[model samples]
Target: MARIAQESPGAPHILIVGGGYVGMYTALRLQKKLRRELRRGEVRVTIVDPNSYMTYQPFLPEAAAGNISPRHVVVPLRRVLPKCTVRKARVTELNHDEGWAIVQPLAGPPERISYDYLVMAAGAVPRLLPIPGLAEHGISLKTVGEAIHLRNHVLEQLEIAESTDDAELRRKALTFVFVGGGFAGVEAVAELEDMTRDATKYMRKVTPQDLRFILVEAAGRILPEVGPDMGKWTAEQLRGRGIDVKMNTLLESAVDGRIELSDGSSFQAGTLVWNAGVKAAPVVRRGGLPVDEKGRVKGTEYLTIEGLVRAFTAGDNAAIPDLTQEGMYCPPNAQHAVRQAKLLGDNIVRSLRGKTLKPYVHSNVGAVAGLGLHKGVAQTYGFKVKGWPAWFMHRTYHGAKVPTFNRKLRVVADWTLALFLKRETVSLATIEQPRADFQLAALDDVRPKERAADQAREPAA
Candidate 1:
């Protein structure tokens, strides 16, 4: 048994793990519903996460394309959950039977936290395959860091292509390959392509015809959430922009910046972005909870673990039954995660008060995807829309759902600013290692002094 932290007297402590959509939304609802209890010290809410903020993942593509600032895409947890205790830590082990969880703080040793109620909302991570050299060459867009890196890397590649005189080198530098055709992959490629197109006007040598964009998907279609017709139309739109969409094709290898596709085709490219899919965060399994075949924690429609009382889960980590779709579980997406979190919060409160718990049943609110600025595809209320109107809807819908008025205002301000100012394409890659120059100069200074002192000491020789 783990050594657990002492709990506050006369209060029911609620421990929420992960600070993503489910964690933030659940804590927000709890704060509102249990306001009296919280103020009176009758209840305590604590949230633990590795990041101090929750990233609005939907805006990541826009951030990558410089359409939105990276800082604005993430909401600081403490600011949003001021009523709750926010710990910058990772939940390493969970022993629900003992009513304690092992939390490894960002700077300190692991400690045990005891709770009357536990919620597992730890989100998913990028699912990477064992394709040769993928781990070395492929970039991901799942996090803000990756998005920023991709933006810098793509711009840097453009610079390289422009400066190079060799045809082979320029061709390799200008070629961009993206794997997976899901929302993330599609949006990331489209947004970056748009940025690249706009950036070329500033470069003397790089032209629109010189750049090549290729999207590879192993499945027969892309954007299946928007139905077959919309998916087809979206593909057509992408192809019209000179994007090569390869369906039913797999990336066989990416060894040493050389790409080999399943269709017996190969090429050299400087950039490779992988956005295939996501799997439940590893913390879920470490918590000792029962998981389904897909490695998701198994929970009832009420978002409660079957054998674990006072324990609930939602978001990408939980496998909750979908009543609307027979014999199916909820799809791991932002829409479901957000709704499930609200319901889970209410259900937890209901359970505490001996009230009837409501089942988590929510039909998806259709799908919307942006294929770069002023271009998008969306399906809502059984109506299909595409082009500028769809793009507008996509931005409007996500802007509304991004959480917090401050962040919403900032996002809107970004879009508003984009109307008047040119898109900022200057790559600030040096930010990654800002201290490198200073450190190198300091080392050089010390080395020369040391060498002169050694020469004086060896005057006789």
Candidate 2:
């Protein structure tokens, strides 16, 4: 048990976990709907998340490619939700029976927070498999940090290849392998490919032909969100650019910079990115909530947990039943997560007012994906679009969907600036460990000069 935080005596508290799309949007909606109660001190809205900002995940690929500035893709929670109390903490445990949750603060001890109502929207983590060496070598693109790291890493590889005279070393440095073919994997690879190709123009030794970009998919087709025809077209388009689109293939191993495929082919590559899939965030399962087999919190069509009236869930963490699809839960994607959040917010308000709740039902809106600059694929409103038009649609749709008008304008401004300026391709990998050199210098200063001289003068045994 944890010590309870101080709170207002007469106000009902609504505690929301996670700061992703669902958590941020739901809190935004709830604050707007419950404005009167909040002003009167009848209710208090509190949100707890490890990050102070909500990352718009759909733009991660573009962020990785330097197409959009990383800072513009995330919305600061404090700036957006001034009325709500924002805690930078992770919900470590949930005890709904006692109406309190355990939160681990960013830099301190765990504390207990009692709530009248709870909303779980912690989102998902990368679904990793037991493939050997994957834990050591595999990287993902789930967060802004990861996206920025990947951009730096990809550029670093190009630098290595450009300077290397050994053909094998050059080959290994230039080869990039991406696993999975979903929207994340496809878009990430495509955008990075575009950036890398453009970057090679500045390198004297490296050319587009020298780069090897391989995409491995276990499924027969890629981008299942779009129909099979579009998936096929997308693969063909990738191949047209000299990318190896290996369908129905499995990555047998990526051990020690050596990649082995099920097709009996192997290669040494410096970069290996894994975007296979996502599972519900561990906090959901570990918090003792009732969850489905896939570890998602079990919820009704109204987005409330089965046995708990005050507990609600949405987004990737919740197994929301799809009324339109028989024997299937809603797919854990941005499309469903954003829609469910809107309805979940409204339902929470209705529940507080003692009104009948409405079931969440939204027909599938088709999918759209960017295949680098001036190239994309989209299926919306029973129509299929490809090439530049699809690319424009992708930007337009996501630009509108990205939460907060300020962020939308910033994203638009980034795109506008790109028209006249060349894409920034310099690697800033040092940003990951920005203080290492300073720390080392400080440590060196602390050493005794006489002891250092004695150690240096001593001969090896």
Candidate 3:
């Protein structure tokens, strides 16, 4: 294997994989705590990720609804981690026992890097099932790009419904199906539905009633993060908004946009969104590391991977013991991910200095979700809240947690400007294929020249 060149071969190097919440926060804390060591070349820190930026996933629903700019939802990793080496690459394999890792860059051969310590924060990917036609027809909302594409696609569907004369085509174009009823699924359907309803007012043929939004959940309730009562309340609110909330139902198939539900219902929808759940990233399982049945790296309360020396983990991919609840593990969410990362960073420093490591402990705060403009539900501090107050709380809580003062300012500014101006409903579909028009023109020019040459050679026609 090829070796990555290191500037300080003698100093202890810390390698952090994945630039998500856990990876970014841990490295940021390390940079500050080990500032003197980093400056003196006594230690080295490096981070690797496929993308140059770390996306704040909470604002994705709003970005999909055009409430916030896509650029503000992601923080540039290079700008934030100026003290550490940030490589835009993917870690293909890990041999923690040998203290070496194989990483594949964007456009090059794989290279192996040796590290004195390893921080596995590789996060998770969408958990998909074997439902027929799902791989081909369903859309995901994991990244900023996906969010942008979904927004444009929804508007395009409305345009199609407005222009089509056939009743079947119009009906298909007007229907949207979303599977899963968790926070991401509920918030996404609500926001996009709101945006679509607002856009219909400007259309000549398409009316708000023509749009059909469906939410499917196998469980009997939605938003289980909150209590069952709140979940039922949220579902009722969605139904009141003219959305079809189907509980205790499964999506059996979606062959060519014809959806078959386990509840004996069928429909044709132009759009299908899948937000069921997510699992550990594939790379985490590829490595010969100790993982539980759920494929998460086994970790102790100190944030150190069990059965491994100088190895640490945090985030959705790590199965750390939850102190608040016996016989249970930490739930995979942004709340725990952020807190574990800070403790992991401190523990790493403490280990290096031969100090006692601290355990990860944080009680459950609560759950909050926004269900369109001035509509939401929240449960925190043994109290329940809904309606506009819950919406305000959701905004306030997440607005403070999005990381970086710069990002916080931009997010707040987006909300501030939204109050004075109307929401922009125009879709820029051409952005997805900006070069299509140029390619078509070139093809047209070539066809004319070819036809003229052929006629001249044939001497007539």
Candidate 4:
């Protein structure tokens, strides 16, 4: 019930849940455009999210490869949204009828928050398959932490490969399996495989030829964000890079480093990275919002939740009506999310001011992916570009669109320094098992008593 001192008798308060792409950007624009409303103490904005930062997911592969620093990929929510109250918590329940929500605050117990307007931008989560051990063993490469973990795990595999004398164990440890063929999957394998290759130069026993990189897709092709032809070409290009592309294949089991696949093939790997796809965060449907076939909030072209007058939904959480194609919905990508955010903001303003809200419409501009340094594939506007141009396009496009100017410059600087600097192959894998070493040390301290008892039981000498 903590309210900032801007309460007029009947001022409108906006409660934005999920400070992700749509929430952050919409509030930012609202804060700027509604400055007078705030100065007059007539309107206010508040944002809530589980994290204090919004992750730029497209840069995760680059971050995993150490092309960009992990810290710079996150935009601090509180720092940018000075005009709004930023609540670091998750919304557990929504009471839209009463204009209130129960928020599980990051620091304290659950509490209530009331507002005249609501924005649902809670975003998405990693979609899992029914395959055994996929949930427990598979790591999703969708966050900054996950990217760092992937980098560390891949490097740890290399280290293990270098020390192991058993050829089978060595091969298994060095094998890296990625189950997905979209941008996240393709880029992740390309970047990490490149990193492994570059790292081999520093290893005494390991080489690029000894490492195995496998990209698995359950469907006929990859990168459905683009299309079949480009996706097919992308697979061929990946094969050219020495990566095994398994189409129409699915991983069946991965229990204790043993793996089984749909093609009756088996292998062992120390690392399993899953980037299959994304489903709208489960909270979206649980919030008592109108959901469609895929559990995404059904919304009109205006981006408002279909049945609610004061509530709106955007980003990956909303099943926004796709005006471009018949009986379709917008794909969950930053391209549409960022574009829809602008109109979401504008429409909110119009709603508050009793003006007409505009419709949301934007066609897919295209997709650009970074394979390795000076290597990528892009098909846009009925044109195909590969090699250096595709790589450059990938960099330039994401560099320009990565949210903040501060991030933009950092990404640019990373690429610029990359030209003259050798790739950093060092991995901080020990972090995953920090406590294991301590446990071993404690066990070593206690083993002397057991050894003495064993010697006593033996024949006197």
Tens digit of per-residue lDDT, candidate 4, span 54-144: 8988899989998889987899988887878888888888878888788787665678767899999999998887888777778988889
* Candidate 1 residue-wise lDDT at 170: 93
Judged by whole-model lDDT over C-alpha atoms, candidate 3 comes out at: 0.93
* lDDT value, residue 15 of candidate 3: 94
Which residue pairs clash within candidate 4? none
Global Cα lDDT for candidate 4: 0.87
Candidate 2 local lDDT, residue 101: 90
Looking at candidate 4, what is the lDDT of residue 1?
47
Pairs in steric clash, model 3:
none
Write the residue-wise lDDT of candidate 3 on 251-335 in tens digits: 9999999999999999899999999999999989888889999899999999999999999999999999999999899999999
Q: Which stretches of candidate 1 lie over 4 Å from their true place?
A: 1-6, 450-461
Worst 10 residues of 2 by lDDT: 442-451
lDDT of 4 at 113: 67
Query: What is candidate 4's CA lDDT for residue 132?
Result: 82
After superposition, candidate 2 runs with Cα above 4 Å error = 439-461
lDDT, candidates in the order shown: 0.93, 0.92, 0.93, 0.87
**What's the TM for model 1?**
0.97
Instruction: Give the number of the best model, judged by TM-score.
Output: 3
User: In model 4, which regions exceed 4 Å deviation?
Assistant: 1-9, 433-461
